[model samples]
Target: MANKKVHTSALLEKAGIPPPESISSSVVNEIQQFRKVQPTSKELVDGILNGNVTALSRAITLIESTNATHVEKANEVINACLPYANKSVRIGITGVPGVGKSTFIEAFGKYLTGLGKKVAVLAVDPSSTISHGSILGDKTRMEELVKDKNAYIRPSASGETLGGVARKTRETITLCEAAGFDTIIIETVGVGQSETAVHSMVDFFLLLKISGAGDELQGIKRGIMEMADAIVINKADGDNIKKANLAKTEFNRALHLFPAKKSGWIPTVSTCSAITKEGIEEVWKTILKFLEVTKENNYFFEKRKVQNLFWMMETINEQLKLNFYNDPEIQKLLDSTKKAVTTDEISPFAAAQLLLKKHFKK
Candidate 1:
């Protein structure tokens, strides 16, 4: 009876059965030795400086964490890593969904790794609107690069907004640079204004394209063209090679219409076959040439300085918005204020002022 199943209605059998123990002493003892303790910020900093990938990943996770407890620790790690950052070349890549971005990135990353460069790729994966979950399939797609000892790929979700992901990525770049990665490739989700956000954070912006039918120039955004340091026409292999060259010529003609860049660097058009790995070396050579030019004129250094200032102001704006919405007084009155504004009982500006006053009073 003790080993057999007993129904609750059978009181005699049920009461006769002994209760389970409160804690499994043997299981607890076995688990205790393997428990992971959170490393300190100093430990993370030292590990990152010593080229430890595990510590670098943990530091990035702390930066992306929404918990309040992680904020201070994250800040400490960043501050410690700041001196070691900015030694790498930060490149941003974006393109339409079918343009073979992953293929090109993997090929490019492998080429860089072959050149003895430690590369870190931060690929932004699209999140489902309904479930808010990301595919994070970059590692799977870039099988060769994923296995390379000189390369590290981290795929992140484009969460509710691009600003959050951009900020996290920017910080991640610093951590990667500190961890001995000399080349940082940031891959955008290739939707909406993600390209603009990524462009602002990177030193070089690459717009990947593929030759298509007779509409090579259709639906291309003028702003994106202006931002490109180079437009790489990918999939230039087999029968597509001719069309790729034609597309390149058309793009170069279109690029000539844009005003000269402040950096005085002419944007180049190149064709590459990610599958065949043809013309991949030209892209790296072009980047090196750009670095030589930009460094000669000091534009590279000045641009980075300006970017740091812009991010400082951006961070201030983000903090102000977060604090205003998270305030206790504002939280209490937010619903009423929003309702009043929606129903025309109060002006939006006036309701905002009231909330600000209430929040400030506290």
Candidate 2:
């Protein structure tokens, strides 16, 4: 019987199966080692300041973490990086679905990198509402730019964020700037309130549109047109060239009706072909000119200051809400309070007041 047991053990070892006890011990050891070796905030900040991409990615992960334990470290890393950030020209790009945003970004990013500029592309992909799953497929679409040593692309899931931007996008931009990216492009999930969110973070907001659609302005919100710094009619190749030109004319006319932007710059309309790479340089030059004009007039710096203030208030609001919702007392009362409201046993306002009173008691 002992020989038979020994033979069975040998066969199990030969089959590459670990003993149950050993398997459990190995997993515990790995978890312990992982926790032990996690980088400190100082180490992450140092790595990012030295232009380490790995450190940048890790820091971003920390920022995106939902774990309460990571919040302190994430904030420390962000504060350290803040002194070195805001050096890049942040640009926001948005367009409706089927407008070829990925293709345009590939060509545009490659062009910027070719000019010896370090470019970082932050793409927000829509998340599945039901499962919270996201494709995060921008890297696959921007194949050529992905290979460029000077370019970095990050695709983030827009989980429940109203604007289709990752919750930590602003923090990620700061990390990228600390890592020496000269240009940061935030490509928002197809047009919506997301455009407004992107506009808040970027120095320039570019709106890309397509041609030959039945109505030139169909499906595009008028508010979006007003927010754009420049509108580019894309896919200006082959038979589409004429339609693109006409769209540009129509957009130019439409833009004239909106109030002038605070920066004293008139938004321009142009045409481009992402595949053929035509007019890409023209669009870039327009951005540079806008920057120059804004910088000369000091609006550029003023706008950034305003943005910083906006984010500071935004962060405080978010933290307050988090604390309110995550409080143990509040959590315990929430289900009953909600049920009371549903059953019409309590007025919604009265229920909210009661919850607030309970929350403040301790």
Maximum-lDDT candidate: 2
Give residue 54's error in model 1 in angstroms. Answer: 1.1
Best TM-score among the predictions, by candidate number: 2
- Indicate the worst ten consecutive residues by lDDT in candidate 1: 6-15
Per-candidate TM equals 0.87, 0.89
Which lDDT tens digits does candidate 2 get at residues 128-187?
989999999999999999999999999999887877578889999999999999999999
Clashes of each: 0, 0
Give all candidates' CA lDDT scores.
Answer: 0.88, 0.91
Deviation from native of the Cα of residue 281 in model 1, angstroms = 0.5
lDDT of prediction 2: 0.91
Model 2 ranges off by over 4 Å: 1-36
